[model samples]
Every structure is written in C-alpha cells, then in structure tokens.
Target: MTNYKRKKLDAFLSLSFCRLLSVIYIVHLPHLDATIEVTLRSMVASTFSMEYPKANRSFTSMSHLRRQLLPKTKDMPSGTGFGLMRLFTRKSPRSHSSKKKLPAGEQESESTTSTMSSTETTSIHRYDSGRRYNARQDIPYLLPNDEEENDRAHQQHWMINVAFGSNFDAPVQDALEKGIEVLDSGCGPATWTLEMAEKYPNSTFNGTDISPRFPQTIKPPNCHFFIHNIVDPAPFPDSTFMFIHQRLLSLGILENEWDKALADLMRTLKPGGWIELLEISYAQYENAGPKVTLLMQSVVTYGKSKGLNPGAAHVLDDMLTQAGAVNISSRRVAIPLNHGGKLGDLFWDDFKDIFMALYPVVGRLHSDLADIEEYKRFLDACKTECSEHQTALYWYRSCGQKPSNDE
Candidate 1:
C-alpha cells in the first residue's frame, strides 16, 4: 500500500479501535477483565496493521485509545477509568445529568410509586420537606404526601364539614345515588373519594393530583386515582362528569390562571352538573395580630414569588360567573381560629399542621420572624391572640351549575 493510503488506514483504524474500546468499557464498566483487554488488543492489532501479530502486539494502544475516546467525568469520582466512556453516555432528558439509555424500542414510565399505607403513598419523584411533595415545573404545592398529611387532610375535612354543616350545598348525594360519576381535582390522600365512594356505592369517583399521594394498598372498587395536572387539558373528554369538586387548590392557582381553571372546570362537567370550589383565604377575616398577619403576609409574598396569587380565592365569584355557569351560589364559611370550642380546636390543629408543614419553606422563602425560635414563639403567641380575640378565617365555598339546554 502507498504511504498515504497506509496513513489514512491507520487513522481510520485508530478511531475504530477507540469505538470498539468504548463499547467494551461501557459493557464491562468499572471492572475490565483480562479476557476483554486481550480481545480488544487483538482486534486493534488486526484492524490497524500486519506488522504485528495479534498475540505479540505491544498493548500500548490502550493508553492511546483512552486519550482519544473518553470524555472527562468532572462530577464522577476519579480512578474508575470511566471518564473516556462518559462521552457516549446520554444526557437525562429533563436535567442534563449523566444517565444510561434504555435499550432500543423501550419507553420510560411516567412515574413509579411505593406505598407505606392504603390511605397515603409516595412516588419516586417525591421531594419531602416536612411532608412529601413532588416538585414539578408547573405546580408549586409545598405540602408533603405521607400518612400524616393524609390524616391531617381528614381532620381538615371534618372541620370543614362542621363549619359548613354539610358535605355539599348542591345535591351531589342525589346525583351520586342515581349512579353518576364524580371527579375530585387535587384530591389529596383521596379522603373525600373514599368516603363518597362508600356512601354512594353506585357512583364512580376519579381522584387526580400531581403527586402519587393517593391510597394504593386499600381503595374502594369504584374510586380510582390519576396523576394529572389540572392546568392542562384534563385527560377525559369534555362534559364527562356529573359532579366535579376541588378544594384548597389556592396554593397552586394564580390570579391569571383562575379564568383557565374555571374554564377547565366547565369543560370537565356535564350540563347542569354541579361544581363546588372551596378555598381558604385571608380576605375579610377577623383578629389576626402582627405575628399572625406577618406570617400570612410572608405566605402571600412567597406565593407571589412563585407567580401565584395567594389572595386569588377572594375573586372566584367573578371568575366563576364569567366561565359560563348559571345559578351560581357563594357561601363563606367562617372557621374560628381560637374561639369555637371543639370546632376551634380542630381548626387550630389544621392550621398548625399547615404551619408546621410549611414552616421550613416559609423560613427559606419569607420570614417576618427573626429566627427559628422566634418563629416558634410567634406561633405560640398567635394561638393566645386567636382565643382572646375570637380570631377566625373564612372558607368561601362557591357552587355553580353549567347552563342546561333549556336555559
């Protein structure tokens, strides 16, 4: 062969050898056996030149191939010899971290979950603070998704029922008894779903949340859980529900998204199906002192930083009306912070649960308190002030019906 031809062949062979090494290194990763090294050396020798026999060839090419093929793994610890093979690794689709790609024709799952209880569970994607929650690029809920939060939600449920004196204002029980379908948006722990499913065995309940915090080990036959984002177009077809319910989504819903949220609710329900939205806000509440107000203001500020309007709950009356619902009724249920006997105690626990769960995030996000201890002291003082002044917050429950054909 001409010198030029031999040189070109040698270069091509060098790269081919590097590629072969790349595959071998990846396949046998942290530990390369003697057999693999000998095979690699033989392949390199045979492919590159006839001057050296396969077995007698100098194995100096290993160092050369390492230099030519591998990319540095800065984040990875040293001495694994995986640095060069890292170049062939694929970046994680979401975070650009080093990861292995699944074999051809295989697709990754959306989420994976492990359960500790039938009432509450956690997905692999969960991020725990005081409670478990999954961080998403879309929603900004801070609470955790464990059994404690689940029980807390159940307690809150009772407190809400006591405050309102009924499970619902609209004839949801009537619809359910007739074997209708129900969709519970942001159904944390599926407490409402389980209860309603047992109460109305004929009705099917679909619960959805961004986190896999729903009951898994034990669930009613009619109740199902779906991981979903309410801001997006719901998975179901338009007008599929008989009754759609949502509560306490104010943590994620923003001022502008209210219109979209209401619109989505309207799109989700059948004609004349009732939609009840319950939200808690600081609008026109009584007796919150500087510490309480400060904590509340910090929450509002932190929510705004995340592009949410914490106070948007107060404006749902207009938004719901604009979304093309008729016979809209708004009920503001007052929850005594420190005044109403056993009811007040439950509400206090509910409030404290939220405060405790969010306390860490609040300190990081917003703090009117001086330090950790000061925040604790402030909370203790708020409890006293609440009882002395009959401090209470209002839960605005607004029910609306889609306009029927007759309308």
Candidate 2:
C-alpha cells in the first residue's frame, strides 16, 4: 500500500488525487481480486489523461482535468468547487509518452490483474458502503450510492409528490397521460421515474444519473435508465424529448455552470417541449430558528467558499429564461417545520434528506466536521425548533417550454 501524507493529500486535492485515492480506498476496503489493478489503472488513466496528442476542445484543456478532479482543496474557490484551471497545459506534438515504471512485484500484480479481468466477467466496484463515488465524471453528484441514499430518494419522491399534490406540476401532465417521451435528469434511485412510468404506461420514460443507485432489474418495459452526466451534452439527439424534468440540481451545480447545463437541456428538448427544474433552497426562509439559521449559514458559506451555488434554486427561473425557454413560470412551496400538519411532517422528512447529505459533503471539505456527531445535535435541535416554532423552508419548482416555429 502507498503511504500518503498530508502533503500527498494536499497535492492530491489539487492534482488528480481523488481519482487515485478512490482506487486505493476501493482496494483496501474490499477483498479485491486480480481485477483491482486493471480497474485501477483504467480508471486512473482515464482520469489523468495527459496522453492527448492534440488539443481536445471537449474540455477547456488538460489542467481543467486536474481542477475537475478535486472539489475539497484549499486552493479552490472558498467553500465552493467551481475552480477550474485558467492556464491550460497544451498537448505536445508527440502522442507516445513516457510510461512510469512500477515496482517488480506491483508490475507483476498489475499484469496478472489485466489477464484475469479479460478472461472473467468485467466487474466494476459499486460504492454501496458509503457516500463515496469512484468515477471522476460523477463528482457533481454528492449523494452516496448506498441503500440509505436509495431510500432517501424514494422518500423524497413521495414528499415531493404529496407536497405538489401531483407527480409532476408541468402543464404537459395531459400529454404524459396521452403518451409522449419524458426525460428525468438526475433521476436518483429512479423512484420518481419508476412511479411515473408505472402510472403513465403510455408515456415512455428515460432517466439519467451518474450514480447507478437505481435498480437495473425489475424496471417497467417503457422505462430505461442510463448513467449520464447532466452537465455534459446529453447523448440523446436534438428534439428527442417532449418533456424533461430535473430535480435537485441546485444542490450539485456551481453558480456559473447552470447556463451551460440549461443550454444542453434545451438542445435535447423538442420544440414546445416542457422543461421543469425543481429544487429545495438552502437560503433563509420566512422564518428560521437560531440553530437552523446557523446550520444554513454554515452550509451556504462552506459551499460558496468552495465555489458551489447552494442558492441555485432561488435563481432557477432566471436560468430557464436565459436558456430562451418560453412560458417560464415558477412556484415556491412554503413548508412549515413540524407545524402539526401532514405537510409539515413531509417537510420535516425533507429536512432530514437535506442535512443527512449535507453533513458528509461539509465533512469531506472541512476537517473540523469530520466527526458528524456535532451535526446530529444540531439536527435534533432544529427538529425541536421546527416542531415548536413553525419555522419554514421552501421548495422552488420552475417550468418552461422550448420555442416552437409557430411561436
């Protein structure tokens, strides 16, 4: 095993360290067979691709790769993870590169792993044990691929459904019933997609997320799930979807990236297709307790410090309009904390969903939060405050439509 010090970690936080650390963590955590070294090399090389012979315009540049790899570094924009390299490392004329030699024993192990991986089933490691993701492209998503996240997504769908009084608040609900193509961006656990698929058998549903948290088996015939990053151009060609629904992107998107993401979605959407973005804001509500306010402040501050936009939901409508969508509209669903109503109960659970994921993200970025026990008391205190004081938070739901030729 490699002995990594804080210096190693610091450089790793700046370099393509998380990608390497992912392999290390996976190797040590699991009873990895010969396949470990092969998978490790592939993932590592994929992430740290300095072998580009020409300038690849797909990404900003090679150094952009390094910035993309680490989100929890001190060198990044304070509290947020939006810092990519301004200076790019241009590729040299030569395609062939110098390969670093490994130890004799390590080389033998890697060689053996490669051979075994080819002959046997191509098994990929799943991060079901915790909230850690292995792939570099999956950095935007913060939630773990565990059953807890699966259940949390499930519960969240139920809460959203009950809160909105419908599965979706889009105007095309009628079109959905009549049968049309629908896309669920960032469809975590596939709960919303699955339920909607079952409900509207006529409508075809496609869901995409970086995390393979959704079950591949036991899905409806009309539904399909793909591992996709919403920030990139969607695999689906232009005018493929009649309706596109994205939920909870505010939690993951940086302040500056939503425009590109919105443009990508607009391109994939058909003329007159409806697009909806739903998010729960971390900003201050109409009423908030001291503990709750403190928690929100820390979350918002830490996120901005890293360059993420915790308040993205608050500005989603503007983004949709900026994307050149027509008929843009929004609704803010006020959720009172434990206000002796069923809705309050649902909002309370939603708060659980927020803080449950929030703790790990902040902990990963800041050392002081490594032990989340402190957050537990804070959550408990906030719960009591909600129950007693009727403090509230809001869910922002916005929908728009692509311009039709006639319009």
Candidate 3:
C-alpha cells in the first residue's frame, strides 16, 4: 500500500481505539475538560506506537491541545469552514495559476512543525504512522458518500436553498469562470478547497490552516496551501482575492476582531466579489414549557460550560451587514438534538450524530472528547422535550457581496 494509505489506516485504527477509551473514561470523569484531555492522549498514543523518550510527553501535549480548544463563546466570529459552505458550496470559485512546488521533504517538515506549534509537541512524523492517521481520519467524515446520509445532509443544506439560493451559487460559479483567486481559511483536511480546485483547474485555490495536515501534492498548477491564523493579518494584500470563505471560527476569534477580519478579507476581494459567513447561534430557549425549558437549559448549559454559546449565531448576520456586504441575509436551520421523549436518548443521539457526522472529517484534526454514550442521560431529557414539541436548535447561515464599486 502507498505510504498515505497506510497512514490513513493507522489513524482510523487509533481514533477507533481512543473512542473506545473515551467511552470508558466518561464513566469515571464527570468533568468535560478532564475527559477531553484523557481521550486525546489515548488517541495520540495509538498514533505514536513507539514510546517517546519523554515519559509525560503525551500528557503535556494533550494539555497544550486543550488550551487551543478555544471555547465557542457567545457571538464567536465566523471562520473559514463556515465561509465556504455559505459562499462557495454550490460551485467552484475562480483561482489564479501557480507552478511552484515545495520539495516533498521540505513540505512534510513544515506540516510537522505546524502541528507541533499548535499542540506543543514535536512527535508527529510525516509519511509515518501519525501523518497517515491524519489523512485517514479526515477523508471519511467530510466526503461520506453513504447515499442515505448524504441525502439527509444535503436535505439539511437544501432547506436554506430557497432563502439564500442565488447568493450561494453565483459568486463561486462566476469566480470559476473568471479565474479569480479563492481562499479557504480554517480548511479542515482540504475537503472543500481541494474539491473546488479539482473542479476548477484554471483557478487557484488557497487553503490556510495552523496544522500542516493538507496533502502535499504536485498541484494541477492552480492550488496551494499556507499556514495562517485567520484572526491575524492574512498573507495576501488588498483586493488580491476574488472571494474569501470562513465558517465555524467561533473559538479563536473575538467579537471586536470581526470588523478587522472583515476589512482584511475585503482588502483581498476583487470588486463586486463575495464573502460568506457561516455560524450557529447558541441562544435557544423554550417559549412556554416549564420542565422542558429547564431541561433544555441544562443541556445548553453543558455546552456553555465547554465554552460554546448558541447565541453567537444570532449576532453574525448583523455583524456581516455592518461590515458593508450587500444583499446580506441569514437562514436558521434546526438539527434535532432530540426527537424522541427521553433525555438520555436526546443528548446521546445528538452527540453521536455530530460525532458520526464530523469525526470522519476533522475530529482527529483536534483533540478527542467524551464517549458517544456520556451524553445519553442528557439526550433522554431532550427527547422528552422534543416529543412535547418544545425543543429547537437555531443555526445561522448568512452571506453577502463586495459592491462592484468600480462599476
């Protein structure tokens, strides 16, 4: 098998094992923070089979990863993942051409260093078991072609189609036609960016992330990767890109930085180009049901304890509008965190739903957390609320265009 394939297999195996350990740890550790760390170490160990010379390296590194976990705060600013799905999902964006090739060895070293700086560990080897693990862990989740699940997810994606239809497709398609430059910030494993590059061979697709886990490839002369933190100044200059895409970046970015990031991204956009914002609000509460609302609050409080505030979703639309994008609007979608009449069932089901959905793509890109079952009790309560028809999840999707000022 190719080295890449082998690494993928190793990652799959390691993640599966750590998932099992997480199931066990959840029973012992009541604290979400502690359990998340333990789960991360187990998975990392599975990747790095050989014992490191440093006895506590895994533990220390896991802590470092935790610090970077940036809690999803209220009104957390949007990131690249949210940007693409909102702005560029319907079609490929325009891109510039480049034939530059960083040597294979040099590229691998850069990726390793990048991962270490974020997690504070110098242990991952490129093309070794750990790197392969990264590849494997990302592929299945983002591109799961299971016709049934894709249908379900596509259905969810489509619910917003009517509300944001033209805004979503036109810019990406326009960019592809014009060879405009595109940026995918916080791109996890290049799922969206790489797919776009393959579809639009004439355009350049730039993917930036703190981890160097992207595939080192001989680009088709139109794609590249960079290590950048989106909250900071981007690498490119003003009006350099035709489009910028950011999604789910709530953790690392603060509220004040939203305008700055907006200005920075606008500087890169060509006249009349597009920018998209993808976010999920955390501010859900029941209207009248007493018991159900309390249970909802408890479940939501747990998320808040982990630094996730559902309220951020509500604020992003206004922020994007204030930044001066035209035709700005947002759609709210609900993912049933609980469907049945049991709290354990509700929380556990949604927890597993999110894990099963995202783990294949990016779970391993970050640290591992609690077991699928740990949230069962919570899910059951949520289900009861849902059965009473008192449960709701408010997720926000918003996008806008840079005015064609030159026109």
Residue-wise C-alpha lDDT for candidate 1, range 209-259, written one tens digit per residue = 877767653455678889887787788889999898888887876667777
Which stretches of candidate 1 lie above 4 Å from their native place?
Answer: 1-131, 365-370
Residue 354's lDDT within candidate 2 is 61
The best-first sequence of candidates by TM-score reads: 1, 2, 3
Choose the strongest candidate by lDDT: 1
1-407, model 3: which lDDT tens digit per residue?
97545654664565456445544443444444744644444454434332111211221122222222222233334452322212111111211111123324433333332221221112232222111222322211122222222223322322333333432433478657668788877654454465466666778889886555444543334668897656568898787777777765553354456678777777777777777767645456433244445433443454444444435567766776777777776666554445433332333333334333332122223233122232334345545656566455555667678788764
TM-score (C-alpha) between model 3 and the true structure: 0.49
Q: Point to the candidate with the largest TM-score.
A: 1
Provide the global lDDT of candidate 1 against the true structure. 0.65
Selected candidate, larger TM-score, 1 vs 2: 1
TM-score of each: 0.67, 0.66, 0.49
The lDDT ranking, best first, is 1, 2, 3
- Relative to the true structure, candidate 2 has a C-alpha RMSD (angstroms) of 19.1
Predictions in order: lDDT: 0.65, 0.63, 0.47
Query: Between which residue pairs do clashes occur in model 1?
Result: 70-84, 131-144, 132-144, 132-145
